[model samples]
Target: MRAFDPFGWLEKYFSANTLHLLIRAVAVVVILAFLIHRISLYSRYLFKPLWAAETLIFVIFLISYIIRINPADRSRGVREILIPLAGAMLPFALIFSPSQNLITGQTNYAYIVFIWMTVSTALTVWGLWTLRRSFSITVEARELVTGGPYRFIRHPVYLGEMLSAAAVTIFRFSPVNVLILFLFVAIQLFRSKMEEEKLGHVLPGYIDFAAKAFWFWPGPPKHQR
Candidate 1:
């Protein structure tokens, strides 16, 4: 049997309007990334404003992530960049070999958002619960946490952030929304990974911890092939 053409439904929306939306969406994502990088660069100097804005934004992201528990967040820096780029590319691509199902009035990929939201939220709570004491943005961090979610996944909070951000994009199902979300995911992912590398290098038993926990998804380490 031939492989199913999952993206075949995009045949119906091959118009100029969709193309324009896609181009604009791509532009928006690029702008967001540039702005975020600049903001992060000087956020320390403008701590109050940056912190306030990101806190509110992340809180909203957290709430959305928690709403869904089964779906999983597959966000990483690559995914963060790809999602918006994909949204932008979708219009042109769909014109020839489409993937979305327009007749249903729903994108074929919406289910992924649902799954990711639930998974991300669960991981976030778990990570927070595990590292209750070490949960500060202070430079000299407190003692390492090896409890709750931390015991299972090394970076549950990051996972949650990625998941939630991606979920929001999928739910909105718009070019602009997806683009903004992609940039947020990319920046946070970079920040988290850098922290993880630094912290893992310092904290004792980190080598063992690294050996055990998965980087993104929260669970027992998968068996090596």
Candidate 2:
């Protein structure tokens, strides 16, 4: 049996490198379809401040998947694969539960929400631009990206995601949404641990980078010893 590298767990069953890639293309197609639906739905709100910036983040995501280079290695186990899939799909699940407003939905709350989204979207796009071809949804060892927002945070993308996701969760507050948000953040943090473990094993410099960089919080970039 051949492994589908892109889907990660499928690699448990499939075997060829090219087969991995072809399946990866299929995975990208699925992501592209989902994101396109999101982009269209959100574009209707383009008149909102920096709304297009948020939309472009999706564009970057699709492009990153399309242009990403092959990983040096990736974990093929089902556990490693499913953790990320859960994080990716968690938000979509929120569509089912009715959205309960967290606050009075005042103009002040609106401004605060928009600000979080704007900042988070900027951070995400910055990390994405830096990560670009090195990006992967699954736990894969690729090039060590140590520049840009990565200088300060070990996982700027995850932080940005956390913030943006938090903002969304706040707006769509509900018991189910809260649980989903908690799991999403917890999974992201755990995924960071998995990534660091993989990178420390596979890339020589990452261990050193991890030491100086904050996990998700902002901090000064790594400096000379």
Q: Local distance difference test, per candidate?
A: 0.47, 0.74
Candidate 1 off by > 4 Å: 1-116, 137-140, 216-225
- Where does candidate 2 stray beyond 4 Å? 1-15, 46-50, 97-105, 216-225
lDDT of 1: 0.47
| Top candidate by TM-score | 2
lDDT of 2 by residue, 1-225 (tens): 224334445556765576657856886787788777766676456236557666667778778877877788665664467778789778677657654454434667767777887888789889988998888776778888999999988999889888888877776777878888889999988888777767777776776777788775332223321
Clashing pairs in 2: 2-14, 2-15, 3-14, 3-15
Displacement of the residue 134 alpha carbon in candidate 2, Å: 1.5
What 10-residue stretch in candidate 2 is worst by lDDT? 216-225
Candidate 1 local lDDT, 37-95, one digit each (tens):
64565545322443343343334333332331211111224333333334333322222
